[model samples]
Target: MNAESIAIVGAGVAGAAAAVRLAERGVAVTLYEAVHEPKPIGAGLLLQPTGQRVLAAMGLLDEALALGIRVDRLFGDTPSGRTVLDMSYRRFHPEAYGLGLQRGALMGLLWRRVRALGVPWACGAAVESFQQDGDGVTLQLAGGRTARHAALILANGSFSRLREGMRVRQSARLFPWGAVWTVLPAPAGFPQIELRQRFRSASQMLGLMPVGKAHAEDVERGINVFWSLPVASLDGWQERIGLQPLKQRMTDLFPEVEPLLAGLTEPVQLREARYADVHMARWHDGRVLAMGDCAHGMSPQLGQGANMALIDAHELSAEVGTGGTGGKDDWPEVFARYTRRRRAHLRFYEQASRGLTPMFQSDAVVAPWLRDRFFGWGGRLPYIHQQSIATLAGYKTGWLWGRLKL
Candidate 1:
């Protein structure tokens, strides 16, 4: 669009990254946030190649690499003393490795870039509603203060009211199981080269990601722990059963986590999170374009949530095709092109994550049984194992299926 300033709702990974890119390209960008001070929530996340490419494009990959722990392998242990996941990044490329990092660290990096570029962030000002016309989009803030921009980018979140207002259709489903996560000092003896998980069954899984440190905060050094827990059974952990039993379960499942327990003081210290798969038919309508979680948030089972969000910001720039200079105001053409280019990639992850979450966290009695019995061996095959690694690294699209026609 020839119009200069762009209104980006949500100061999240998607919005922040897009803002930084757009601003650097000389497009006037204003990021609106609901919170008085926006901060990243959640524990650790893995930055796959797909995500790193985006950071590199934005000239921040080196900084991102320095802020997080380097992860080269993904190893898992099952209740029966069997290793279910034993994949390594080396299989994909000799130097390729996923970076395990605090979610806040990455978001902070993006926000810092946004700030450096002089992109104005309207914090504490919630965009209550928005209006769109043939020319530009107008954002109505909480206090009725309105600002108009050439285009609207929605990265608010999966629970975004703006996405609802856009009338985008989707089949959203919540996973029965979620996670309770906490950050603990990385145990001196803990290996930081891999993202590890211990599982007793589908319902009992513990993911321990070595998230190095936070550069801007006092509490810099730590690892992230996420335990699989069902929503229906959460009250029991808080009231009826108590954390003592859960603590005992931790010791039995993976004694290695014992060193990290003292830092957790109490179960109440950990926060719970639920994941949902929002399957939208498209990610845009009119001048309003949706990206990240609000458009297509998927389960973290495959560890692609943040990566996909970052990639969305990258691909979006291409579809927006502003060329570092304002272009046409053809909203329909821009939105349609973005959707077409991103659909295949989005479809793969949504399907892969949905298909695999059950193997790790679910009430399905036979699912876990089948996983422990077959997954270990199946994951060892050269071709199958390589495919799994590709999926893990966010290269699933062109790995095997791109050339085939259904």
Candidate 2:
């Protein structure tokens, strides 16, 4: 394998994006996946304009736009309509609406495009271990399959098996509160073009985002409804009562979601998730590089997980250019450049997510007070409000770095 060649581990959004970008630059690349047929978990995701820009750069914007709901504003309010957040993409730019998309549809679209790009794929190739030296990186997959590449990309995920061995020993913290989410038919009075979230303090939280018809399943059920609860309480809570109580709680908190909540009469009808923060001192090691959640994963507080992953992939792929077989002499420095280019952007999101999570997902303790005093009002300030909007739209490179035009 020459330096122009890269073998990517994990066929997720990051891996696939990297593969397509590098391939487009006339580089030889292959994407490997642990599963033979990869599928997205049953959930919806918010694709911010920055992510849309990334896809647009990849020539996928039009295709992606067809698969999701277009949300012009992000509105978070208490039951009594006391505003917690009221940020509009139009505040940042006219064309900066967020995309409420079903994860399955996004993944499916990417997979098809990757296949069309003719990049080779090695599926069922679970990379159990890897060894990186000055020459190159070698991966040992399950069932004794082995592969080597001049440069290997670890784009797997937050809990990466390869990241621990290569660089950055990070202890990813699990949030005490996660979310229970599901998709159902949008109620008669549902807003089709906005992400409306209900929040009272922190313990009482619910999100209703309209996810368009991504696939056949979504044709009937298009709104994604989510309820935030303590992660530790799921087991005991489920055993102690039935879904009626949960539905009642959601209905009591956000009556608008009652139409969807009524269908969630069974706990099994929804999925729960606990977010984590994956921190790394740096994001590369010699010819081996980590991208996406493998390098820097943060909570969904900012809703930038997928956008950040797209940025990581695109940045690295751009740096790993369309040159001839460059060899090991140059890649390490190139990887360093990739880190430098991505560091500020990545750090801003991580810091923002950390500061924002407790406000929305915790027990509200002191965070609610802190949030109301700082975030709630600060977001209304002219300058700070725009900055917050830029951050939410995935454009901040640093605190004072100003907005980054994608």
Candidate 3:
């Protein structure tokens, strides 16, 4: 499989990461993107250890670290601002640290690296259809262009069209709530702050993450305000997304945290609330394989989205490098092996993230008290904090890096 040409669909972090890894191995790679230019649509992202390791592996860690903020701890709280849990990224994965950055910034850095690695890419080109023979797969682009490769990696994301041919099943869960956020001016001489999460209810949680140093254009010049809540749908999003409404709501329910809302002068960005899971049952049939959100979508509560995608790239690239001698018949074994190794970790994170909703949203009188007690007790036990951090940080060894020793 030396110098095998591989087609990678989608250019998000997962697709780009895969493309970068394959190209670094001297594999001829062509990346396809439906969008003319990748743009940031989501809010901020926290790169857990898994993601950080992938970036470090690509030699982009220092660059990313410079553009982001490293919070010393993860602090969970109630609407009343009672601290529920406090843990740090280092406690979870001592080898690496977690940092917060805008989704767009991360993509921009990856895009630069992808081009520098010499991976050929076709933007604004949709994959209309694809067919795979025993030897390779041929893809038809939206504008009538075509490309052929020995293998195809579908990192096209959750709503991937390629999943149709793979015959994968998908299920969605709508939490009847959603979130919206806006950036604000950072305070002058403000101290570095930890990421904050406040549970207003089972269907709502607010996260405030410090992404970078304050800029002049950010009004009020204090910090970014991410106000998320559970809503029924888009019908009332405009009203609910208003700064006044959000400010009022926070003032009523979270007086302690409300003072921070005074700095939220920027327009609120409303985001719909929906969750889904992708079950390919088989990741590859013939030369096509799905990774990242295309393979499995988990709630953001765990903040493992980017982390899981990077780990997928790391493992997939390793498999491609080691198992290239294998023919198409070998892919099923490879996919099976990949699935077997990742399924447990993915499920663990999924369940762990899902479990957070109940604890955060429980309106029971005793629930908040219990949650506070749990955090207080956990804080007293540093080892327990470390174990919890490792699990959330996605630092499992052997299965991930193998003997790469990184």
Candidate 4:
């Protein structure tokens, strides 16, 4: 009823963050999520400087800080626990480097902020279809609830039906790998989790992260173990193996990270680790646009999926708050500008992440050895690591809002 009302689909982190930002600027927004209700899912997510900056802008930095553990340094090691490379976070970024937090907690925090801001939301109301008229876009819910908005943002995860109108295509490829992740109670005498990267010659990369706390009543508060094994396929991946085998294989492959895995009581095979990518010629069509994973779903190798979503929300807010590139009537040029601004940065991360995957999964002895040696040398190059962090964190981008001269 006031300002320009925008409808954001999928009230996940991206949608919630965007709604909060827009509401803070005095714009009314309505968020829609297909899920019947938010569920406790997902493990830990790495919050780098890019995400931290967005959280700070939204007054969530302090809260997130309290809920997260500041990783003092990053370590890369062999399966035998030999430290191959190590770098401090403070050395990379002056303000902060990275923090680990449960995805549920992060989403909970954003949801609270969205509700506090009085943004209207419709959950469990999956969109049946949508259409654009001369004035605005009309969204039809599966339950027959109809809504309209001057603009629409499709943040409904990777399988967004609303984004189909934009000609987006999705590819679900089975990486020669799959992963199992679960959280365990941090035993009273549990060993402090050292960020470990277990490099095995078998082309399997296993990682154990300290999730800080577990919400499950049955499980003691503890660490989250992420096992990325080279699976030839993901078909029936979930039933292929169980926690004990995974733990045993990991322990046998990388003894260093084995201690952390051994501490776990059981592993929750929450979701199958299948690599997917969503491609769209453009994320926007007229007043309707897409953001987050719906617009660009990428491999988790970069660990920047959520971070990139935050960035997308931030940039979209900026363009709209600044009057966008067009009036409410015309959004072609506006969407074009948004695409141009984001494509280059997206490609950089995409290429870099994809490049690293093969290296991690390579069975060739000489290749992996050379790859480790390269990383070893890279660790010695101070600027190389800084630059790596900057690029992945989206710090060095000219299009980043803070870096914008205008």
TM-scores of all models?
A: 0.93, 0.93, 0.83, 0.86
Better of 1 and 4 by TM-score: 1
How many clashes in each structure?
Answer: 0, 0, 15, 7
Q: Please provide, for model 3 over 1-406, each residue's C-alpha lDDT reduced to its tens digit, 9 standing for 90 to 100.
A: 2225788899987998888887786667889899997775555677886688889899988877777778677787765656677887766556445677766667877888898997788889899888888777888889787777777888887767676877455443444444566654455555445777666544455667777632223233223455555545344766645557767766665455555565666444434445555555556666678888877766666778777888888777676545556443255556566666676666666666666645554344565556666765776597777666776677643333322223
**Ten-residue region with minimum lDDT total, candidate 1:** 397-406
Q: Extract clashing residue pairs from model 2.
A: none
lDDT of each: 0.81, 0.79, 0.68, 0.68
Q: Write the per-residue lDDT of candidate 1 for residues 1-406, one digit (tens) a residue.
A: 1245778999888899889877765668889999997777667888997788888888888877878888999999886689888999998789889988788889878988998898888899899898888888988899868888888999887777778778677766776777788888876677778888998878788888888776744455678888888977764566755677777777788887888887877867778788777888888888888888888888788888888888887776676654333564466577778888888888888888778888888888788888887788998888888888888888766536651111
Candidate 2 lDDT trough over 10 residues, lowest sum: 321-330
Q: What TM-score does candidate 3 reach?
A: 0.83
Tell me each candidate's RMSD, in Å, in order: 3.0, 2.4, 4.3, 3.8
- Tell me how far the alpha carbon of residue 354 in candidate 2 is from the true structure, in angstroms, after superposition: 0.6
The alpha-carbon deviation from the true structure for residue 321 of candidate 3, after best TM-score superposition, in angstroms, is 2.7
Model 4 residue 268 CA deviation (Å) reads 3.8
Q: What lDDT tens digits, residue by residue, belong to model 4 across residues 234-263?
A: 355446766576667777876655555545
Error of 4 at 131 (Å): 2.0
Whose TM-score is higher: candidate 2's or candidate 3's?
Answer: 2
Residue 282, model 1: Cα distance from true site in angstroms: 0.8
Model 4 clash pairs are: 176-231, 177-231, 185-220, 185-221, 185-222, 186-221, 186-222
